[model samples]
Target chain A: MAYNDKVLEHYEKPRNVGSMDKNDLHVGTGMVGAPACGDVMKLQIRVNDAGVIDDAKFKTFGCGSAIASSSLVTEWIKGKTIDQALSIKNKDIAEELALPPVKIHCSVLAEDAIRSAVDDYRKKQKGGVNASGS
Target chain B: MNRVDVCWSCRGGVVAGEGFCPTCRVIQPPDPRRDHFHYFGLNPGFDLDLGVLDTVYRQRQQQFHPDLFVSRGATERRYSMEHVTRLNEGYRTLKDPLTRGEYLLKVTGFREQTPENATPSDPAFLLEIMEWRETLEEVDLKGKNAAMQLQQLRDRMMETCDAEVVTLGKGFHDWFVGGKREGLAVAAQHTDRLRYFTRFLDELDRKSELFF
Candidate 1:
């Protein structure tokens, strides 16, 4: 499928495509895989002591749409607080990239990754360092 | 090949293809309308005999291959071409365990391919996937005895896939026997896992080729 210009742009120059120290107390890591499509996405966020997102990074192994979605979310979450980051919906991402209906799941996955990351962060903050609480 | 015309062998009304027309001696051509199981006259379940499938495929190809219809008229030739393609597709879909499981999922009316579907909340499974990837990555990076290592990786992946396929088969059997929607959903999730495992296996195959 021919991706729209925005998706291709994101794919060509994906932002913050790497990993952070998952063990860091201030760092929250979200690892998710779409079993249906065999796509795995790891999104990590570094929260400041001031309760703002200090940085965000991601590494995804999947199709262009998935990669683009992850890349887009890293940019979206960088400056936002945890509460603000939660507001990023899959529909907004889908609309922003003009992802076709079939690729809407890619956007949904990005949303899931973000939420998972935020949840991880919250858990760590509440349960102290190295918390793997469910 | 559904038409109002009569069958050439038994003069029976249009009948869907199975092994052959039951009343007549003719090996019936494939029907586009029928699912893969009905196309091959097999019961709609994961448990299938490859021997029967192979023989039926060979016979169907022999009867309808375009090469055999070279001397026939255009309409007959067209029908043969379509039927031959359908038969080959049916054979391929049924012969593969992964595709066969997925085919059952679709025919069982659990057709949604949404991303939110079955993300595998089981933390143990997620951890297993992570370990599997870490192991495969180590194997991918090593240079010494790469072929042997890739072979072992491939074997491990195939073993995992086979186990998952068995699980999927059980899910299918449960649904077929007990008629539960949850059974089909669980089976579909297994199919999802099988597909994920196959992607890794395929990568291992590619690495093995490059290593050797």
Candidate 2:
């Protein structure tokens, strides 16, 4: 299937494609995969103490859809509150990326990655690495 | 249809006291009596013996390979080709444990791929997946040792996957023999793990290819 223009654009030049310090309590990282197609996606966010996302980055290994999905989400999550980032859904990513039915799982993987990264950030906050254990 | 053991010649007498008709010296048609497991010369069990399966598959392919009949008439060649095709399909289905379980379920008229049936029951597995992904992202940014560390991590993940496969085999046996409902759930869990392992391996492969 022909890719959406936006998806093709992001895939060609993915934004914020790097990782921050794992030891940084403010950074949350997530990795996910779709078993059916053997795709892997990694997403990370740097959140301030106030839970406002300051930065986002991603890396994906799969088809164009997967690359676009991660790229789009990384763009979406930055500057948003943790709550807003958590609400991002696979359908939105799929629609935005114009992913075909077979590639919907790629969007799901992206959503999963976002949730995972947020959860990791929360865990680190609770564990007293970056933030004092509340 | 004539029973495969009976000979048409000698008034349906057993030829060579086995498969041949003694009176006409005619060889009987190949037996269609074998089930999928028996056709591959395996015990009728859910647990697969992959070594034996591979050996039998190779042997069967060698024996009935279409190339062997290429010089023969079109009819014989077509028959051989069909046999080879079926053999390959059957081998593929039986080789993978999840596919094998599904095939058995289909054969037994209990074919079901419901979401509940295919989903993993353990919530911890999902949590584990999340943590692993976090570690992967951490390593992705590390320039020099990133590829090497990813390979080592992937090797460990594959070892875990191999163990899961073995556990899946046990679950299959339990399901087939004990009619345990949980066997299906276990099978589904293993299927998920297998997919994750495959994805991780593919990632490592991509990184290695780019570096080298």
Q: Tell me the whole-model lDDT of each prediction, alpha carbons only.
A: 0.80, 0.70
True contacts kept of each: 0.40, 0.17
Q: Which DockQ values do the candidates obtain, in the order shown?
A: 0.45, 0.17
Model 2 bad stretches (over 4 Å) = A1-5, A18-32, A40-54, A59-62, A81-89, A112-134, B1-41, B44-46, B68-76, B96-158, B206-212
Which residue pairs come into collision in candidate 2? Answer: B15-B20, B15-B22
Interface RMSD of each: 2.6, 5.7
Q: Lowest summed lDDT over 10 consecutive residues: which window, candidate 2 chain A?
A: A125-134
- Per-residue lDDT for A1-134 in model 2, tens only? 68889889988998888767867878887766665555656688999877799899887767788888898898898889999999999999988877888778778888888988888788887787544533
Q: Which segments of model 1 are wrong by more than 4 Å? A: A1-14, A21-25, A91-101, A127-134, B1-14, B18-29, B112-120, B138-142, B178-181
| Residue range B1-212, candidate 2, lDDT tens digits | 22335554345666221323566654333345545676676776567778998998888788677777778667556656666776788799898765676666555544454231112234356446645655765676348887788788788877877888787677666777888868766765566576666566665666667666
Per residue, candidate 1 scores C-alpha lDDT tens digits across A14-93 of 99988888888899988788877777788899999888998999887677999999999999999899999999999999
Q: Give the best candidate by lDDT.
A: 1
Model 2 has an lDDT value of: 0.70
DockQ score for model 2, please? 0.17
lDDT of 1 at A26: 94
